[model samples]
Target: MALFIFRSIPMNTYELDCPAVPFETVGKTVAQVVSRIEQRLRKAELEPEWVVAANWIDDANDSLHGLKADALWPVVVEGESRLCLSVAIGRSEGWLVQIDHVRLHKAGDGGHWSSVALLRIKTLTRTHAWAVAAAMSRLLEID
Candidate 1:
């Protein structure tokens, strides 16, 4: 029953021991998801800068077509293919902690906020990164 136990698995290899709200599908397009995430973050009392960046790149068309980068980064999730996000958090130590492999999931239903999967970022160990991940998770609800 120890926390911070790392496990290697197929679906969520880096899953973390955290609490998350129930899954809720809310959007159709990536734009909607970004907006929803932004709104959620704001409601959670997170600063706009903390949200970092958000964007979506179409892989089906096999071209660098439309992409948005600001608070929410977008990626195509087909079935079990998860999207990973790397976030950097500033700390009082005068260095940034990088959180890599934050997975995202696409909810079966797309209405306002696209369903996203949450993967525990193993590489992130710094207090700042951990705090950022927890706050962002609360805002994005990727659990």
Candidate 2:
């Protein structure tokens, strides 16, 4: 008989294949870029609520000034009937904007949510922010 031994090896989550796409800044600073995006959303009559993530900023208000290029900023927009949009500010390599459709499930007394990515648009410049807002508007059919 031969003795068998097995060892558990930890995996590095950061090693995952996450390609970074190029992003061109429309404004001189990150704050300006975010402001423009908010303006676009308002023009479409969509109320945007910026949210804070566990590994991200502590306060939502901090997003405007402390946006890290290597970190992601999540923004939640209100208007769609059943769909929701989330925008991430940056990635390891460049800036990326992703839009997802969220579905809510009711369980007993509590509820859970699931999401499917509707679009993954790499922002090449500041104009891309407006593009993202427009895509969200069209998807939600706000007007």
- TM-score for each model: 0.36, 0.35
Q: Mark the 10 consecutive residues where model 1 has the least summed lDDT.
A: 93-102
Candidate 2 per-residue C-alpha lDDT over 85-125 given as tens digits, one digit per residue, 9 for 90 to 100: 44456554334554444555668888777654333334444
1-143: candidate 1 lDDT, tens digit per residue: 77797787543212243336622433334444444555654554432443321223333321222233322333435454334344453343222322222233445664232333222222223544455455545434443
The lDDT leader among the candidates is: 2
Model 2, residue 33: C-alpha shift (Å) = 27
Model 1 ranges off by over 4 Å:
1-19, 50-79, 89-132, 138-143
